[model samples]
Target: MDPGSKLPLSPHIQIYRLPLTALLSVVHRATGVALALGAVLLVWILALAANSAEAYGQLYPHLASWYGQIFLLGLIFSLYLHFCNGIRHLFWDIGMGFDLEIVHRTAKFAIFAAIVLTVATWAIAANLEL
Candidate 1:
């Protein structure tokens, strides 16, 4: 190695076009982490509810606010995505969906199912008083 030679740089995300399965794997892990974080919010709400109705009432308005709604939406999507991807992984454990085409199709379907299920869940919740 020459002392004056430029160091070789390793390939990075910018240098690679990740396949759909790779990207979805990343998203699945990310959503799993996000859901863990979201659990804190759920716990906070539960604690407030358990303490007193008055305390819960005070926090409820903020949760019902626009920013809160966005957070809930993100949480709901994360839940759905993680759940669907988990089912995908389960099928893999059962020795199914191993083909490259099947993998790609299932990844895409997971995303679509998450979106549809999240919307459906919110729709049903919206109609109820809770």
Candidate 2:
């Protein structure tokens, strides 16, 4: 190796294409933050539920709005994704899902399963007569 030779630096994002795994990694962290915030929101809902009917009534209207619905939907999606990916991590802890092909396939499957579960949960919630 020539001590005076200049090493070529890697191309920047402007010249690079992000891969699925890279995107998923970023989404995982973002969803984790979302889930933490959702947990606080859930605690607020529980507090409302435990209070008197009049107090609960006051909070219910806000939650019935379209914006609230969207936030709830996003929380549900984040919860499912986090849960599914957590289980996948458990498998990895046991020394599985390390193979390149298996890792990609399982990650894809987990994402799909999370989406399906989130949709199913929302559908059931929508159908509830409450």
Candidate 3:
């Protein structure tokens, strides 16, 4: 390495904008992490179930509050996103859908589907709860 030679800079995140495929890949990983956290919440709910109905009854309303419901809805969105992305990956494993057009199109579809499914699921659940 010569001191006079400048090092080449790859477009770092601060400099380079990520494309839809790259952004969705990052979001997929983030959703995986969020799903783990959601799993922990489920475990807590399970513990309550195992302990006593009285225990869950005391906690249900708080879990039904605005923030809790928002978190649950976010969890649902993550589940759908992750599921869809996993299917995308399976297609990749089969050596399919690597074209830029397909990648971007599927990425957009996954995001849209996740939102739609989450909202639809919550709407149905709310109706049933009533």
lDDT of each: 0.92, 0.84, 0.89
Model 2 spans > 4 angstroms off? 1-8
User: What's the C-alpha lDDT at position 5 in model 1?
Assistant: 78
Per-model TM values vs. the true structure: 0.87, 0.84, 0.89
Candidate 2 lDDT over 30-107, as tens digits, reads: 999998888898888889889878888898877789998887888898889888888888998999888888878888
lDDT score at residue 14, model 1, on the 0-100 scale: 94
Candidate 1 global TM-score: 0.87
Which candidate's TM-score is highest? 3
Candidate 3 clashing pairs, residues 3+ apart or interchain: none
Per-residue lDDT over 89-129 for candidate 3, one digit per residue giving the tens place of the 0 to 100 score: 99999999999899899888888888888888889999997
Q: Is 1 or 2 the stronger prediction by TM-score? A: 1
Question: Which candidate wins on lDDT?
Answer: 1
lDDT for model 1 comes to 0.92
